[model samples]
Target: MTHSSTAPTDLPVMLPATYRGPDALGYCRWLAAMPVWALPVMAGLVLIWPTLVHAQTVYSTEKIMGIMAKWLPLLITKGFSMNVVISFFTMLLGTIAGLLLGVGRVSDNRYIRGFSWLVVQLFRNSPWLVLLFIVMLTLPFEIRVAGTYFSVPDWMKAVFGLSLPIMANIAEIVRGAIQSVPSAQWEAAESLAFTRRQILWQIILPQCFKRMIPPWMNWYAIMTMATPLVSLLGVTELVTLSRQAMEAEGNNPSLLVPFYGFALIIFFAYCYPIARLTMRLEKKFAVKG
Candidate 1:
């Protein structure tokens, strides 16, 4: 008998073959170069596939669609409007408070500067939820404003809570923007015998406005997102309404993903445009500088 050795090429392969399709290099380059929309289309089809199969089996597609159709209008009109209203008041209150504190931060008096600094630090360091709870649960239900008695709404508490951190952030923005102005400009104003207030109002603050706007819009987007947190305080915002919709569907766990996904879409649709606008404004202001 003669001894025989197998060549490597003649041996049976034990390793799995590598995948070689459109994903492989030099294989269907056109597929690789397909438009990005194809990805979302494919992904969306895949995402809905499970739901489709389940609905076909369980006959719940029409039911889910019916629920969604009913809730959609409420979410858009009432829930979204509530979110916007709370956010607007929050921004208004925050901006006014922040402007005051920011100006106070740079004041000649040490007491005013210290007080503003303390206020900023206190609110900035506190957790937003803690502030929300404090405002919503701890504050008296009825408050006397301008000597008139009125009941404070839960949504108002949400705004008040949300504004605290916003105020601090805007204060910092204001302080930094004001301080960033060149000392030469201040000296020029002083040489003209202009009062500090006049110099600030006419020269410094005006310049700060452009700088402040970009950050202000950025913060507005953030605060708008945060508005959903008000739902935790029993305010009927988008997220809260979404929850109610899901529950109304007999607490169907399957509906959770769809409902929440719907809310996510709305938020993205709302915020993404604002974010893009903010970026554009920032670039425009930057180029002007």
Candidate 2:
């Protein structure tokens, strides 16, 4: 009878006894138990790395990673920066429009209330991409006034497109926040010789500010994510610039993962902290019954 040097022939012989990795069957079982999206996502990166390294075409002295590193910062400067600008302006415009629409929703005048509700429902239900196309195509690129031409930039159109949905959403947020204030507050303010406008501006709206904030931040994050859609409009955002970089590099198939991967990383980096902060604020501001 022969003694085995390794009882576990399937496992790594060099690994220390305490840290020997899982055997193939155990690893397969573990993978099977993971969520549906988890395996594919893990596999996409893991499977692609070695394949690209072996197959990557060396057009310049630079390797795939170095070329990617050079462009990553460029992506930030030339591309993702525009995305941030669009998101900021979109949020600002939407907040203002939404405030007016929300006020209208609560207006005593039936006409104002009906108009606000109609605008909200229409924009809220429409697809964002459709809105973007509508706005971009319908608006003139430039208009002349007094022999001077002012052009509407594609990024501005993106802002308008994004703002429509945001405005509709924020209007709902405002309406809900305003209504969440007790009717007693309104009645009490009315009894104190306050006009309807005074009751809203002085008493109800002040209380609603905290309630509106978490959702406003949430929507801002969402609008940031959606800014990538503007790339379709040829608005020079991250994805569009990434494609341009790839083309300049002779469109190596291998660069797809690194370029898009870095973009994914940057977008994730920007949005994830906002999401965490959103959760914390929600918990912090949650009202007790």
Candidate 3:
């Protein structure tokens, strides 16, 4: 490449292709695209954090990281996996319930529509932590069905709690997606003597599917990050189990950064890609209304 000899060495680069190179947007994408473990590894380099040096033998950063490495499996299996499980189930349950609720919001019946709106507002406005606490406290520990008792697990309760908000948000997404379809489609379908149900299921809903997907993925990311809230309710998900592992390993001040920071790093690792893809889908499916 040819360049002016008088060119300043430190001017921001502009890539010849794709309009990228340490500019604001490119820099952000680059940062978010970093390896999953990159942030934690960076923290490890700062060895011997002054604030973490308590009144005891200061552990080397290498030893702190080694401790984290040794307990990595437990954190992933018992802790992180539960976060995944809770997020998955929450999204699943929420999607089903939300779809129904969304349909209800647009239902022809006044009562059904009113009830759906009320429910959506109530749950969507409620604090997530409060909902978790309410579900954890109010639900029976065990239930009887056909003279058989099955006990509810704490994590399951957390899933139920999280699902409520997800359901509300998704209900809104569904309603909006459905409404975004041009009214002319509905009118044209009706011109063909198609019933409301037929138009909705076959014509309207098919178009709404693409519009709904990006928001659905976005909500899943939000719900996954919120899974850590379960830790406060004594659920043994990633954050909760992370703390237990820290305690088992002596709860050194130095361990805090690596352990909790590791959790944050992995969560970002999981969510950032989804966020990027969501943006892409949103652009691809941009509804010209």
lDDT of each: 0.78, 0.80, 0.81
Off by over 4 Å in 2: 1-53, 56-62, 144-147, 287-289
Residues 1-289, candidate 1: write the lDDT tens digits.
1324444574446334444542211211232234435545544653474466564455366666677778889988988889889999999999999999999889888999999999999997688888898888887889999999999888888889999999998898799889989989999999999998889889899977988887787778878877888888899899888888777768876666667767666665566667667767777887787
Q: Compare candidates 2 and 3 on lDDT and give the better one.
A: 3
lDDT of 3 by residue, 146-213 (tens): 99999998888999999999999889988987897899999999999999888888998888898788
Q: lDDT ranking from best to worst?
A: 3, 2, 1
lDDT of 2 by residue, 1-289 (tens): 1333555545665544553552312322332344555435744683466355664455432466667777878899989999899999999999999998998999999999999999999998699999999999998898789999999898998899999999998898889889989899999988899999988888888888877876788788778978999899899999999999999888987777777776776766676566656655666776431
Task: Say which prediction, candidate 2 or candidate 3, comes out ahead on TM-score.
Answer: 3
TM-scores of the models, in the order given: 0.81, 0.80, 0.81
lDDT of 1 at 178: 95
Better candidate number, 1 or 2, judged by TM-score: 1
Worst 10 residues of 2 by lDDT: 22-31
Candidate 2: give the clashing pairs. Answer: none
